[model samples]
Target chain A: MIATLLVVLQVVVATAITPLLIGVMRQVRARLEGRIGSGVLQPYRDVRKLLAKEPLRAEGSSIILVAAPLVLLVSSLLVVALVPLVTTANIPAVPNDLFVVVSILLIGTVALALLGLDAGTAFGGMGSSRHMMIAALVEPTVLMSVYALSIPVGSSTLSKIVVARGADVTRVVTPAGLLAVVALVVVVLAETGRLPVDNPSTHLELTMIHESMILESAGRDLAWLEVGSWLRLTALLGLVVNLALPWGLADSMQPLALLVAVVTLGVKLLVAGGVIAAAEVFMAKVRLFKVPELLAGSFVLAFLAVTASYLAG
Target chain B: MNPFRLLKLIARTGRIAEPAPAAPVADTEHPIPKALRGSVQVRHVDTGSCNGCEIEIGAAFGGVYDVERYGARLVASPRHADVLAVTGVVTHNMVEPLLRTVEATPRPRLVVAIGDCAHDCGLFAGAYGVAGPVSDFVDVDLEVPGCPPRPEAIVEALRRVTGR
Candidate 1:
């Protein structure tokens, strides 16, 4: 019963906090540009307005095309439920390996991208192709980085990784751990479409990857896409925090401990958001051709970390 | 020197000055009125384009981009829309549907023109069947331009509509 309650809380919190994280990044970006931005709750308002609008359908859309977005949202929510936030005590975390979590995320991306192609528009097909190429590159780096950390813990379970790191402070300071951190940072950048991988800000046709896939949807459908992206940002950040920070993860079901854990996680996420915004400000979008080199570098770093950890052990 | 501090100052100072009131009562938080509760009603119309933007927009609402949490939703009829978001370019084939959408929607409506096709004609610019621009059909308040903009950008544009 307690576990069930925690799972419920996890979904509620993930849903609620996702927008705030996006808001913080926006606020940070606006501040860097010397402009005051909208309130963090502004996303919530936009979503409300969207829901009240009517939906329109295109002529050529098939059952698969219409159902794809619903599946994408459900899959994302399932992943959010699986990922323990605020407290590890609520969910039985072992069934979900890092590989499994990453795969589910990829499934969501692929499903939506394929739906883009199903739309039968030239841009949709073009966007779908580019999105797949990027995903193909991203998957290996993501797996390799998690494997680097998983080796040190002797298990790929997210909870175990966080628990092992929390129980043993000496592990995180090691050379292998440092390299893994570096690789994970890059993966976050790539997965979230942050600058130096794919810039979310740019509208230039030659550069976009994720944006191209969604050129046809509007109204409430667009709103769901926004919320999902925010949840994704939260989930990725959760991985960075739990794996890299690993401090204060609740080991018990006690309410107070869970509360403290939630606060700690929030602080960590906000800091990451600020750093990302700052980094985006300082960096230009990596040229599309250079993306492969960047992912290759990440793979090498991850490979080195795994080898180093094995040798040290 | 924290960025939030600088932005708040800038936005606050940018506010237009108005006549003084007898008592200045400030509302610290924006209220989620009862009317905005539950699902948000939406009307989506494709002006014209290759169809990539529509797929992404559809994906946003499905399982991945679930917009339901914000008490908003997409309604099938334009008469129900408080928000009107149009995708694709304004093509000759789509002008009737686009205009019909504008006429069907009520007053004080928010119009979001998503994707580069809708914004600046994108790759569909010179096509003979295209109606040229969306502004020719309906008043668009927000333009989310990309070959297809990311869901994150689309949501940001919507947030601006609510004045939240």
Candidate 2:
């Protein structure tokens, strides 16, 4: 009963906080650029306003244009529920295996790429192709890095890995752990379309990888796409932080433990988001051709991490 | 530049945006839609301009003017926009594209005509290629009247829509 309740709480909390995370990141970027940003609550307003407007679809476009956003949103929510964020206590029926989690994320990624292609616009096709290329490179690194961490726990279930790491601090600070995390961070930036990989705020269609896909969608359709993408960032970033700092996660169903878990997760996510946004101020999006080089370099790091963990044990 | 130098420069530059002026009094003639009151995404359409209004529009969005602080953002697609910031006189060549762009935007949208050229064709009133003022081609909800309206004027017009 308590495990189910925790899963419910995880989904509800993650959904509520997703928009705030995007708002906070934008606020950080605006401040670093020496401008007073629209307040952190602005995303909530944008989403509400979008929901009130009529959605405009392109003539002759397939149902994928209408259905992809929901698919993406649902997949993101599933990932959030499966990942051990507020607690390491597992629900009996749901599998939180690393492979399962990665596959769920890919479902959303593919949905977005298809949404891009459904419109049949040049930019949409271009964006879809680029998005697929990046996803192709990003998935392996995500699997390998977690595989490296999984080696120490002798299990591929994410919640189990987190629980084991919380029990052993030495496992977290090892050379193998450090390399996997660095690789994970790079791939996370790439996966989430942050600066140095993709610029989330860019207006030029020529430079857009993510935005170009959804340019044909309007009103409520746009809102779903926006929120769905934001949720993916939230889920991935949440997983990254929990893996990096396994402390403060609730181990049981106690009320006090749940409260502490919620507070710590909020603080950790905000701090991580702000740090990433600030770091982005100093970096520019790499040219599309050079992106493979960056992703390849991270892959090498993950490969090294796996080798190191295997040899050390 | 190296990371160290960039860090020092950021610290030294500090805040460059001027203190924001008081919010504009709500325009009774053009009451903002309640839905768009807090946030408005603008898609700029250049019908045919001397490029003067384009530069000023750029300035309005730049760090110094920082119109985005009012929750008015420039978007890449009209489908993503709540307002069309139409600039310049409607030239013969641009009439169809402008109409298509406006048609592409979802309902509950506003068109804000920027510069005297967009309002009345300014000096381009009788030019060979000039079709008409923006209002002649589409319903202009707001007008910023200057040969090339100042950035502050452009910012003020957008603020009226965002109501922030």
Candidate 3:
């Protein structure tokens, strides 16, 4: 019963905060660029307006156009429910294993890739192929990095790993932990379509990875895609922050503990998002070809983290 | 540039956006719908302008004007747009593309004609290649009436659409 309550709380918290996180990031970027930004509530307003408009579908487009956004959104929600966020307690019958988490993440990735292809436009096809290539590279790094963290915990479950890390501060400061976290950070940025991998604010279709795919989507469809992607960012970034600073996560079903966990999770995600946006102002998106090199470098770091974890354990 | 230098420049050149003017009085004939009241994604279409209106449109979105503060953003595709910012006169070559772009936008959308050329084909009024004004091609919800509308005028027109 407590586990189910925690899952509900986690989903509610994540859903409420994801748009604000995107808003905060955009505001940070606008400030750094010396402009008066659209207020932090802008994303919520955009989503509301998008929902009220009619979604136009291209002629001959299949049901994939209608379905992909929901799949992406549902997969992200499932990952949020399963991953340790507000609490480390697992919901009965739901696997919070790292592999399960990664597989669920892949479902959203595939859904988005398919959405990109369903439009059949030249840019959509290009974006889909590029998205697939990046996903292929990113999934391995995500798995390897989390596997390294799972080593000392003696289980592949994400909650167990977070709990173990929380219990022993020394473990988090070790070479393996630091390397894996850094590698995870790079992959998170790449996975979330942030700068130095893919620029989220780009208007040029030719330079786009994610935006190009959704160029054909409008109104409610675009809103879902936008919110779905934002939720993915929220879940992944929450995971990264919780892993890096595992304090404040509720281990028991205490009301006060859950409250503290909610506040801390919100703060960590927003602060991390602001820092990322600020960091992006100084960096440019790498060329598409060079992206593989960057991902390959992170893969190497994850590989070393696994090796270091075994030696240290 | 060096990262430290960039940081210093950012600190030095903080907040260049001009203070937003008072919101325009709401239009009764084509008042912004409730859904688009707080946010509107604009997609600019340059049918066949001589580039004057384009320059002003750019300035409206740039740091000094910063129309985005009002929740109006320039998007990449017509599909993503809630507003079509159509500029220049419709030329024979551009008429079809302009019509298609407007058709591509989802319902509950507005089209704002951004210059005299888009309104009545200004200097290109009688050009052999010119098809007509933007209104001849698609429904224009609003108009900004300068030879090349000032950035302020362009921003004001959009603020009316966003009603921010």
Docking class of 3: high
> What residue pairs are clashing in model 2?
none
> Which of the predicted structures, 1 or 3, would earn the higher lDDT when compared with the native?
3
lDDT tens digits, residue span B56-143, model 1: 7765544334342233356544544667889988878788878877775644466779998888788888888877778767777678
Worst 10 residues of 1 chain A by lDDT: A30-39
lDDT of 2 by residue, A1-313 (tens): 8888888898888889888988999999899898989989999999999998889999989999999999998898889989988887777887899999999999999999999999899999999999999999999999999999999889999999888888999998888888998999999999989989899999989999999999999988889999899988988899889889988988777889989998888998989999999999999889999999999999999999999999885
Model 1 stretches with alpha carbons more than 4 Å out: A90-94, B1-164
| RMSD list, candidates in order | 10.2, 1.0, 0.8
Cα lDDT for residue A78, candidate 2: 88
| Candidate 3: stretches off by over 4 Å | none
lDDT of 2 by residue, B45-91 (tens): 99998999999999999999999899999999999999999988998
Q: DockQ of all candidates, in order? A: 0.07, 0.87, 0.93
Docking class of 2: high
Rank order (by TM-score, best first): 3, 2, 1
Q: Compared with the real two-chain complex, what DockQ does model 2 have?
A: 0.87
How far out, in Å, is residue B63 in model 1? 35
Alpha carbon lDDT of residue A163, candidate 2? 88
Query: All candidates' lDDT scores?
Result: 0.70, 0.91, 0.93
Of candidates 2 and 1, the better by TM-score: 2
